[model samples]
Target: MNKRLVWPLWNLALAIGLGAFGAHALAGVLDEYGLGVYETARNYHMWMGLAWLILAVAG
Candidate 1:
C-alpha cells in the first residue's frame, strides 16, 4: 500500500493484462512468428515489472 509501490504494481498489472489480450484477442490476428515475438516482449515486460517491484520494495 506504499505510494512508491503503486507504479511498479501498475506496470505489473498492465503487463499481465496485455499478455492476456495478446493470447486471446490477438490469437488469430498474429501469425506464429509475430506471436513468438510478442510473447518474448511480454516476458521481458513481466520480468522488468517484477524487478521494478523489487526495487520499490527494497529501496
Candidate 2:
C-alpha cells in the first residue's frame, strides 16, 4: 500500500486501540467526572481518526 494510504489506517487503528483502552483499562481508575472527560477524549479521538480515514479514501 502507498505510504499515504497506510497512515490513515494506522491512525484509525490507534484510535480504536486507545478507545478500547479507555473503556476497559481505565474503568475504576478514574472517578465518574474524570471518566466522563476520558470518554469525551476517546470519542473525539475516534471520530477524528475516522474523519482522517474518510479523507484518505476520498482523496
Return the TM-score for each candidate structure.
0.97, 0.81
lDDT of 1: 0.97
Tens digits of per-residue lDDT, candidate 1, 1-59, equal 89989999999999999999999999999999999999999999999999999999999
For model 2 the TM-score comes to 0.81
Local distance difference test, candidate 2: 0.82
Task: In candidate 2, list every pair of residues with a backbone clash.
Answer: none
For model 1, the run of ten residues with the poorest summed lDDT: 1-10
1-59 in candidate 2: lDDT tens per residue?
76667877887788889878878988869889988998788788778888887887788
Q: Name the best candidate (by lDDT).
A: 1
